[model samples]
Target: MINTSTMVAPWWQQAQLGIFVHWTPASVPGWAPPYDPAGRAHLGWTSYGEWYENSLRFPGSPVSAHHRETYGSRPYTEFGGDFADALSGWDPAEWARRFRAAGARYAVLVTKHHDGYCLWPSEVRNPHRPGWHTPRDVVGEFAEAVRAEGLRFGVYYSGGLDWTFQPRPIATAADTVAAVPRGAYPAYADAQLRELIRRYHPDILWNDIAWPAGRAAIRNLVEYYRFTVPHGVVNDRLYPYTPLWRALRLPGLRAAYNSWERRTVVSDEGFVPKKPPYYDFRTPEYSHYTGPDPFEITRGVDHSFGYNRNSGDDSFIGRDALAALLGTVRSDGGNLLLNVGPRGEDATIPPEQQRRLDWLGEAAGVGSAP
Candidate 1:
């Protein structure tokens, strides 16, 4: 455990604010990403991400219909077309400027989602990879840009791949009777993970889905931390039993000091109860995928953290909502990690979001970080 006195306060305490930015291949398609028909339908297509692997499993579900409409008989493996020209015009520096103006002290970028597309080039197991990869190391650029603005950088990685690939068992139904042979793909997982750590040196690593359970995963985590940053933080999403992992596996782990924010929809019920010492950080109280209601709280005058092409009103969070969210989260002794979805090209935050955040900066007294 890192000594609090000798150690700096976890970034959450110091930052008091963060930004959750979800950029994926789905972000490129400009269409609703695919979904798991066998699961919840309201989650929308991309909510479960690249569910084509499970499309056959569900057979003729709404998801399949939507996929057919979107791709027109094209196989799911062809989803790379979405990213074909998506980031070609992306500019990370401009993205950093908006985040900085929004008063974010740190930012979390999704390096890879369940779609299995890598934002940063990797030498690990490829997931339906293409001949031409993302022209630039998007993840690397994001980290550099965010840091240039003097914010700690974070990487959000999905642990489980959507079962749309050759090694298909990770996609097995939750209640499947047959146990799929769990291959030792730790090399692939570890390779990408290690590369991220070594290359960008992110301050926080936020993982989703299963935490890559096993001793070897723990070892890789330890080795990475010891070598890259002695004071970096890792989330508990990797462990089933927290206390054991907290004691045995975690040495430099942030002390119940969640530096990274959990991305999810917040409900009107106010604070979501978390396990003791598990900080939810900057998660939104509600999800846009759930559809809008009057009681729904959006960050700005525009009712979203990102640019919602489907929104008729073009919601942008205003000063009142921003202040309310900050006060509420701080009162609960938590940090807020707001989200922003930039346009696919030029990495520009929608003008509406920019205007509101600008107003917020001037009005909310977000002022200097003193």
Candidate 2:
């Protein structure tokens, strides 16, 4: 087993609040169907604006219709250029200040999302899309700013799904599993992650979905990470796929697994993976887990983790609700990693999101570092 015992209780455990930043090319369009709490969990109709490119692949989906009407014949790749242009106005220091003022003890930025756009000018270039990464050193600037403000910094990378490698539209849980690209992807992800660790030395390594490589590779990476950053923590989503998981992709099994996954979400159980070789804490998205293990409850202030144009005041977590959530999570010995999805065009945190952060700052006393 991976020797997590060597490290003391991680800093994240005591950090009751962290800010999650999700800025991407998808933020340029920045639209998603209005989230319906009572509706079924359909991938195509997902409320996450960050999934715009994937959602566009589904014919007749709202995003597809929106894209066609808004930016006819313009490929999703073009958004990368638009996003780069928008960076001219982005101020990472201001972002760090906002996060610090919100009483965040730590801040985790999505360095790479599913769409395969790198926020920093990464040395590991995308093979399919040349120079797909941002010209701005977003990751470096943000990391520096956050640390300067005395808050721990972390990076979020989508290790399992890089649409540039597979470009598959995932509608089902099985489809998600199958979409984990094989071939050069495993090494590519590994190198990028190592680079993040080498450059940032982040306090938390927050990975999403699953690692495309199997258990051994993930274990090795975790070992290397702990060795490099002794106090750093890794979340549970790095669990690797097994032969049994691969079997879920079979047509007959795919439908069954998909049905079960949807049911789990509807029932509010969410999809927590079986324990991997090792993890410092569990991460549950838009779900709650009150078991014995340490976990972080991550969700957008609104229903979507990315800025959704459809999200209004009604869609946001109210001040009272947010306070209750914080109380409950703290009582259960968990942390809350609340997300902020800034408007891509101007890098402005929406007033709705800013108001909630302001409330939190006032309630918790701003500028108090954990």
Candidate 3:
């Protein structure tokens, strides 16, 4: 919905490499499977981390049953408010330094996850008031740090998928819908988002878990380009307005987002089903725990990039693997986005991960180390 006239940089020339950081208050305890009474693993908890609320639509699933039992059938706010101060030792500068050293052209940090906890102060709803409210403006500091290192800054917002804010789905017609109209919330969400834009001036808006009823919210966000960032790029996954506008036609649509990037995983079903044309860019994000050969981004290294607390082994892509992967993508004139899930509150990248990523940068002949 952003005005087409505001674009400054040609979409075809967007950065070829991006680093996605997925940190949530839930990540404080690290990645763990949700428990169930019958001892069967829950489907919702298994796929994604921290975004459990978005997947709780199934009626009799473990997440639903477990949530109802623990929180007395209330909304997700109850559990969201239960976050602890696990990251008293967070240092944003260290993280920025490492990311820059890793040759990341841009970085996406989690501003507000599905749990409804805002890393920076939010005026809209004190969703995580007593638990993790901070006056420090964490996201602002991240933007400053990232920009200082000369990398593009971005924020990953989950406003559309806040279980604490919109506990039940739009299909659930209840009094809650009247109290919180999805239509009006776009302005509130925009207000909160504007605070970040005012501070960070991010180049990209990475949104997650887009819903049907929340279309206006993102459209309003695009409209913001008229006043604020005229050249800002928004991911279609944010609110499903359209696939990222791109140039080179992959299997998907080649219209709006002229530079497209697909975040997929190695699966038994062959990298999961997607629309045709496959498109301009596709970055397969292998999780912490996956197979050896299939998980490898290239033919060389065997590793996983997504966060894994227990993964002490260098299961992620190594320098050789990274170089080869980037080389392959570059040969085709596409981009690569490596993801790292930082510890909650502890904003710095883990020391071990940093060392390996540094090695990758060195091996790939990218990024100057600070």
The per-model lDDT (C-alpha) reads: 0.51, 0.86, 0.51
lDDT of 1 by residue, 130-211 (tens): 4423656888889999999998998877664423233332222221111111344344666677788888888877665444
Q: 1-370 in candidate 3: lDDT tens per residue?
A: 2322123344424466666776665554343333222432233434244544543566565446655665566654443333334445666677777777777677787788655677786666644244444455778888888888888887877655555556543221111122232544555566767777777777876555443234554555656743586666654344332322111133333221212222342342123212211111122333221221111121112222223354444444556666676676655544555666665535456655576567757765776466
lDDT of 3 at 153: 84
Model 1, CA-based lDDT: 0.51
Q: What TM-score quantifies how close candidate 1 is to the native fold?
A: 0.68
Which residue pairs in model 2 clash with each other? none
Compute each candidate's TM-score over C-alphas. Answer: 0.68, 0.94, 0.65
How does residue 290 of candidate 2 score in lDDT?
Answer: 58
Question: Between the candidate structures 2 and 3, which one is better when assessed by TM-score?
Answer: 2
Q: Tell me the deviation in Å of residue 82 in model 3.
A: 9.5
- Candidate 2 lDDT: 0.86
The best-first sequence of candidates by TM-score reads 2, 1, 3
